[model samples]
Target: MKGVSTIQSFRVYKHGLKRLIQALGTEYVNLQNVYERLLVGIAPSHRIEAMIDDPFGELWREAQLLGRLRLRLWRSFKNFEDTVHDMREAVQEMMEKLGIGPDGEVEWIEHTSIRRQYKRVSFILQRSNYHDLLTRIREGVSSLQNMAIMNVNMESDRILRSQVRLNQLVNVTSNNIYHALRSTMTCRCQRLHEVGLRLTPPSRTIVPQDSDDDVIKELQFRLIISHMGPLATPSVRQWSEVLLQSARSQVREEPTTPLATKSSSSKKSVKFSVRSSVSSTNEFMQASAIIQPATATFSLGSAAMPVDSGMPQQIRDLCETMQTTEKRRSGDNCGHIQDHMSAKPSEYGVYFMDCLGDCENYVLVPLKDVLRDQSNGTLPPMLYSDKLRLAWVIACSVLQMQETPWIPSCPTHDDFYVVQKGGVPQYQNGFVLKHLPDRGGPGSTSTSTTSSARPTLLSLGIILIELILGQPLESLQPQDTPASQLSPSYEAANKFLGRVNMLGDLGISAPCNVVSVRYLKARTRRVS
Candidate 1:
């Protein structure tokens, strides 16, 4: 009976192993298809060829390693499958040779042989390490997928910057009107150096078909300004010098025309020559004046501008003349101007400028204010789809700007703002504000240290939780806790997680409750 029981147990074990092998085969095929797709997607194309060249070789190397590991895993699985087949055949032979006793007991030798075979199979399974190999293959595939995503993001950023068309030669001192507007605003302002844009959308024109239908169309732009510190004077000077040198070179390359001389008509001819020379000189001067400002408005790079020591005086005089002209036009009127025509920079400082790109009728407002109004029941709750999209945008922003100076080490809700059109907040159009540290300000060092030490992921998790709960984490803290020893935010997260099931009662969907619980629990673990 014992021998029969052993044979039955071996048969069940063999069946289980066969199912596991089949499942692993299916997983391997699926993984291979995904891996092949990733390889093709990440291949260099004409649009992204420059972006993926030598600069991103690490990703290529990782892909190669993944392919090697996958091949090795396939080979190992095949060998394990063959070994399992051999074990099954041996078990069948041993069962066939079994001898039964009169009392319904099998031969001891056969039972011992089956026991030994089971032990051998167990040892071989442990030695195979098939589970570990599958785990590694899955991780490799995931890593490759993440690398592909990063590549796409980098290419998108490049395209976005190119489309924005930054005016590198913009005269900071002369463009003070933007600075004045920024100073008067209630929110903190910081320059977005990576994305400086000035866009003016083309206006629609209605051609007149009748005498009374004549109408003029003018292009309009919406200006968005942020305060900036002292301008990089050296960069500006270098740009001016290069422009002046280029103009001088062009003047030298032009050939001089010879004046006509005749004995009988010398007097008339000489007067005509003198008049023509004066007109030409005046035209050249006018052309230079017009070209300088127009060209400066479209120039794109500071690094490419060459320094010219010989033209320093000329460049200085030209800049000073332009500044004086701007001052005369602006006068002392620094008050708010309703029309773009009357707008002028204040005498205080320079400002960074941005403009709505193709967005006709929109204004920006603080996201914190929108949320507060929503909580007060003055505004409608955000749509679920918008919330999900906002979360995705925030996550992508963190990934892209983690190493950039524009993003703070620990970002909060206040760092984001929303777009409003016709008095309705567009939550999906939210953007993260840039950070600019005050120069030589008190506590700057300590603030930097503290922020650097804090985990940015934890802050992101808290922000996500707040979005899910539709309330600030601070508002959920227990009032009984003393302020002196309280970590209200962390405690609130823990409490929220503890009663996460209650979210369903408040009309929150089961999925949202699950997400909130996960975010809070992860946040709690990080805090501890």
Candidate 2:
């Protein structure tokens, strides 16, 4: 009004002040109307003029702040969305390559035993692939964790930058608008007083103000929906790393002492004992070395050492009896103990298979050493049949005999098949399991009954079948047959001997080589 001419004021007074409003101070409008409209925030949407000629408009500053706020929010949301998408893709690829289920099941091997045997090179290639994929998976876990932290930091930086911008814009705009409003309003108030008129300010009704709180709540809601908790690495990978690291810790030196060293006279002979149990459910396949002079030998552990493993206790006892520092160290030895002997029960853990933690295989003693012992001169021609017969003898001696033919608690097989490191075989991941006593009935205990050597007869028959057919009784069963029909060792023994009995009566000669026939005849004469 001070800048406006008297004609303009008369025109404004006659018409209305709405058309003359511009920034904080207007050329043709009074500052009182502009201040009241901006502060109370009930202004009309229509602009007074086509352009904001002055830069000190409070309404314009509010709109600019809001627009920039919206753009910052949009950018933050987009960045979060992209991070989520990339993380999802990375996790998906990790799951596929690692062959792990969401529920933490590991694919033990993609190839079956037969497939690995037949396609050796292909299996090797797959193993290499698996190794690399495993390495990537481990690396990815660490990388993903770092990325989560990085994203959180970046998002925090973005919000802080936007906050700085908002503060800067708000500060400049507020100062300019405040000074302009004061200058213009003071002049108008003085003119109105000179005209003998009093300017009465309207009483603004104080309503409950919650706009700032509401804006903060909306931001919090957005943050909650876009949180990065879901981006954590899968638990399977975490548990698997635990297993891998645990296996690495189990690596130890193999015992290189021989089984038959004479001990010093000062040590007392400690008689070691065994716990025996037979299993009908498990089918054990001997290594090919079982039949050769390079027989299955033992080393203390393969990968894991039991905290209270009976193996160590028995080894101590063995050392006492032998009176030597090294007790029954495995390379090759006499065929004294055939079956594996453990104070507690044991199963053979697969080489790499168990390192992942499935851990459900049987263990064996160093009968290969005994076979090597037999391979020496002056021992009988324990060829294919003799080797098996000796195994049968050793199995019987370990089970029913209660004799300490083999003094060691754990048994082992030569891991010549495994890749050697620094010229020594890995043996800490090792143990020995003895042959189970042939059970008497469907629910019979592993302990042999006092009844006549009927178990021995049936076992001999099964052994005969094994030597003649060169296959397991279970393997000989008709394909597609239920295991229940041929269940338990007793049932197999009955079936095996029955067929052999018929073959003998029919003068079929029971299919034998000269050495086997001679050995059988001599043994039969001795028994009869």
Candidate 3:
């Protein structure tokens, strides 16, 4: 209700008081309201109006007021946003410093932060194009280095410089991203199994025995499969099957032949057919029935069987004693000591086979050394072929009696052609088996029984010659044996016995030219 001047003055005074409170106290003020407060501070005089009238002065005054208001608002939010940005940058820098992977992306493996937040940070980093960014950064660095070397004009270089700077910044940022990715990519898996991985071995420097390329390859396959991802190498299963089948083939024993004998071939085919048909059955039996008889025999000239001329007197003496006892007792008298002596059984015939190399085609043989098991414990025994048992010798031989007549026929008179003839020639080398009685004369009814028993025959004449002769059979005697049987002296017995059985089978023929004892001494010498 006062005059306009008086009302204005009072209003100005009220504005001044508000401005003072806003400046000195923690009161809030908006821009539009603050202008009145500023205007109130100005003296209500023509002097203030004169200053405002200057060029652009009114706009400047408004801007100043607006800026102050904006600054006040910005101050309130400053720490909240800046602190958040600083923490984010720190985390990103940490990720870059550590080398982890998805090669170029941040994997969760690297983090210094508390474990709980690592996965969360990694997820954010994954969305970043780490690889592309890093590539650009490297390109930018190259450009900067080139620009620095060229030193071009400012105007022209100015653009280049700006481009270089921008690229450098981009590159630096990208590098930081890449480093973060590398650190995070480190493997955090505690166990290989967790990742379905195996450990693959590196190549070895030394080779072991029997380690051929194929074998080494197979071993490598297995080792890699067990160590690395198991699914990566499946060749191991195929290799195992092949090795097993080869072992199975080696165990089958038969005379050496090119096509496995046709009969055996047929049998094998049949077995495969049967196996395919039923999957399981008596495969060996069915196969064996299909093969032809494995051996053959032939009859040569029927000669009179050899007689035991030396034992005739002993046999006669035993018969006489038995008769004398019966006569003295009239059927109840006991036999006298002489009668028992006459009845004493002679030791089984000790036949010899010519083992001399030249005498029987000089075939080399391999024999298994005998090992005796005793009740006390296993006695240490050396094998003939082993270095520890130098004194022992093992030899194998086969006797061909029909071809070599010097070999004497024994009680079991069946020819050896049935069991050995068709095999490899080496299998038919001369052998003298001992301890068989002489068979009865050919006309005897019991002769057939003796043939069924095992044959024990010898090339005793040829062996005696080797005993008498010091020279090897090949040089000193004929390959063929003498047709006529001759009685050998005790001197022959003393010869040809080194501690070892060099000529395993006695089919070895002795040289006819040497003295028996001399050959005997030679045989006694241990082979070095």
Candidate 4:
């Protein structure tokens, strides 16, 4: 009777302890939710003024301090949650050993050894510091809860009252994008350097689809980007010189073995035949022109010619001539090319071998083309999720490449491209091609007053609207108003606000109601 009584007592105590721990965990989670909401609300304004040389330096400092405080509080709450979880587990295990069910019912064990184990476990539970620890955790959680509430209210008030300066926001957002790109290359040894990347028109290769579903599982843009050293700026002439020098060096390092001898003998026999069949420079140029413009329009039924089969004879001859030069320099280790190419920049340098092979395989089609095709019923309808994902990708890309050489000052749908493979567009593989600046042409460095005032942001908003409505920005022009008379900013703003008003009539039931509401609220707050 006494043993049964002891067992019942132990079960009750442990059950109570488990409940207390569970309650603490629930409180911690609620506190965490509050913290997350507060953070999200203030994120837009966070560090937004970092790039601007404004008088709000004190405000920026205060925001940073508050951000740090929130971080520290989150960490403290996480630790408390973990500790509470451990206590709950310990209490549950003690109860289970004593033959107590989850509902606090005791499983009567008649064996003497089992009864003795119950007593042992009960004694350990009593001696344990769980009670003191729970008390401390409860107190800590209470303190955190109070702090979280205070911060949340403080941030909410700030968000409601503060108005972001348009010009400052533009500069800061651009700077933020640059910083985001730099942060992505976490390795201190690597830096983001702009390089000229050329994209050729795509060639279709037919393949069987895994499923008949219209949804695109993945999209890839067939574009190439070269990374020079962190500090190395890209130069077309320098890149070509490096390539030529590397080829020469490779030739000099080749051993004069039996394989080399046979290869050279074979080359001598093929050289005369290649030269005899080579066409005139004018004929080769015409052939090149024919191939270059083939990318402008494509058909589902059309297939590209094989790269080597379509190579002009003159080009092949030039390649052979370069190879012959390399073989001739095989014995001359002290060549000028070696000395010139061996010189390194003060910072680390990584040279990539340029892909001068078949360009048809690396072609990229513009995003506008895909959108047009879809609208014209030439392609499958894009899923809502795909549209959302593409919008997110473009937004991030704008942030990363806004001030860089990769994108123009005001990028449109034309700047973004999609990779088409086997006549099917890879919608997921959309990318932006790097802008190749013309030598002595007007530089892209000069930012006009209008462009300096949130051009990227305006462009981004327009593109997003285009994606949502599955139409180009031009289509949104009011029928009565001539587009030529209005500035692009005014036109886009008028269209966007009109759409927001339409969404307001539809209430919160529309698919993009949340976005519309947020936009309207922000605008309203700014106006006030």
User: Considering every candidate listed, which one attains the maximal lDDT?
Assistant: 4
Model 3, 1-528: lDDT tens per residue? 445554454445334333322331221112112223323332244434433332112332333332232222222223322332332233233235323221223244334433333334334334242334323323433333333233222224433333343333322322222222122223322322100011122212211121232222112110000011123432211100000000112222332321121122221111111112242223322321211121111111111112222331212222122222212322121211111111221111111111121112322221111111111223233222331111110011112121112122331111111111122222212222211111233232122232311222222222323322322222332336353312223232333333113545223322222224444444467343
User: Over 4 Å off in model 3, which ranges?
Assistant: 1-423, 426-442, 445-494, 497-528
TM-score of 1: 0.32
RMSD of each: 31.3, 45.7, 47.4, 25.9
Evaluate model 4: give its TM-score. 0.41
Candidate topping TM-score:
4
Model 1: per-residue Cα lDDT over 193-289, one tens digit each: 2111122221121111111111110111122322222243212211000011112221122222211111122111000001113543233232212
Against the hidden reference, what TM-scores do the models get?
Answer: 0.32, 0.18, 0.13, 0.41
Say what the RMSD of model 3 is.
47.4
lDDT of 4 at 508: 17
lDDT of 4 at 442: 32
- Native-referenced Cα lDDT, model 4: 0.39
Full ranking by lDDT: 4, 1, 2, 3
Candidate 3: C-alpha lDDT:
0.24
Off by over 4 Å in 2: 1-388, 391-460, 488-528
lDDT against true structure, model 2:
0.27
With candidate 1 superimposed using the best TM-score fit, by how many Å does residue 199's alpha carbon deviate from the native?
19
User: How would you encode candidate 2's per-residue C-alpha lDDT over 1-528 as one tens digit per residue?
Assistant: 543454443343223212111111121122222222222222234542312222123333333333332233333323422332343344334344434334333343334443332243233224344445334433433443444345444545655554444333322322222222122222211112100001111111111121322222111000000001112321211000000011112224552332112223332211111111112001111111011111112111122222222222211111012112122232111111111232322211101111111111211223333334334532333345443443333333222222121212111122101111233222222212222121234233223332332233334344444433334455567778886764324455445545655545322114222223444565678799
Q: lDDT tens string, model 4, 255-354?
A: 2221111111111100000111233223322221211111111111211111111211211111112222322222222111111111231111112233
The lDDT values for all models are: 0.36, 0.27, 0.24, 0.39
